[model samples]
Target: MTKDRSVYIRHIYDCIGWIKEYVQEGKEAFLQDRKTQDAVIRNLEVIGQAVKDLGTDSLTASHPETPWPQIAATRNFLAHQYLGVDLTLIWNIVEQHLPKIEQQIIAISNDEGIDLNAPNTPELP
Candidate 1:
């Protein structure tokens, strides 16, 4: 893969990792608590940053299965305006959308011959 593609894939993997972490712990419970909403929004911001850094063009052109623009926009909203962040919507996206997107990333990586088990991979932006 080209350097840019490799970077994007790494970003996707990082997002997947974050999602897994959120799910594994009881972090999902935060979605229902208004008090923990800020933390959830913060994590979503990270997810969005990774998506934006991955870029829409290459992702759409190559990995059409992923919704790059929507992901980036979500990230933008979370980062730029925390007050506007909707907890319910964020919760739904985390519970419903992220897992599927994660699977697609893994599939694409395997198809492109990426080694997920490789050591010291660069952090995705």
Candidate 2:
């Protein structure tokens, strides 16, 4: 439904905001601390859940570049196998993949006529 899509889009926007915040102030610190690592992992889980909730149609049809499966799998691994989670791999995702994902979200929002600079936008968890 339209409401569901709106929620998913908001989640995507929130994830992008979190990524930006982490990159801006926490990137170096996150790379050095376990607590920061865990926090970022949690944020990734939130993003992954949002992506999963969007489903394949929303991801592939509406936002083709969003990597929904990988996001969902990451969420699963973090939630169901936390002990086996790899910080290095997570760090790599943050450093390499997040920027592209953010760009894609921004592009999708623009295409859909959503304003990225709007007031009172929700912050990412």
Candidate 3:
């Protein structure tokens, strides 16, 4: 069964938070640290997948300005083009786009009355 849309939003929000934390040292550090690059890329992948799982209808209607398709495309490129992935593009995305994306996600969560910061634990069977 599909999970709630809020769950995906939370995942995206959390991933962005993690990415920000990982790159706190800035561009030069990020470029030099392979571990940080992997971590950020992994979070980016998660963000893209979460966006894909969240689907397009509500996202487009609620936030038409958000680049949902491009987000998903980035995930696809990261997942498939591992060898050819460009650090510069990833850095640019983090530096240039993530802040806006983060704000948009916070707005979406607020509009839906979902607390993105809340604990998201699964129920036991």
Best by lDDT: 3
Measure candidate 2: CA RMSD.
Answer: 3.9
Give the winner by TM-score: 1 or 3. 3
RMSD of each: 3.9, 3.9, 1.4
The collision pairs in model 1 are none
Q: Please report how far candidate 3 places residue 34 from its true position, in Å.
A: 0.6
- 1-125: candidate 1 lDDT, tens digit per residue: 33555566666677567655655555457655565566556666766776677677867897887788888788777777765766667778877888877787788778888766555356466
lDDT measured at residue 99 in model 2 versus the true structure, 0 to 100: 80
lDDT against true structure, model 1: 0.69
Between candidates 1 and 3, name the one with more favorable lDDT: 3
**Model 3 regions lying over 4 Å from their true place:** 122-125
lDDT of 3 by residue, 39-125 (tens): 999999999888888886668877999888889778889999898789999999999999999999999999999998798775456
How much is the lDDT of residue 108 in candidate 3? Answer: 91
**lDDT by residue (tens digit), candidate 2, 6-88:** 56666767765775676565556767877667767888888788777867566778776667688777888888878777767
Q: lDDT scores for all predictions?
A: 0.69, 0.72, 0.90
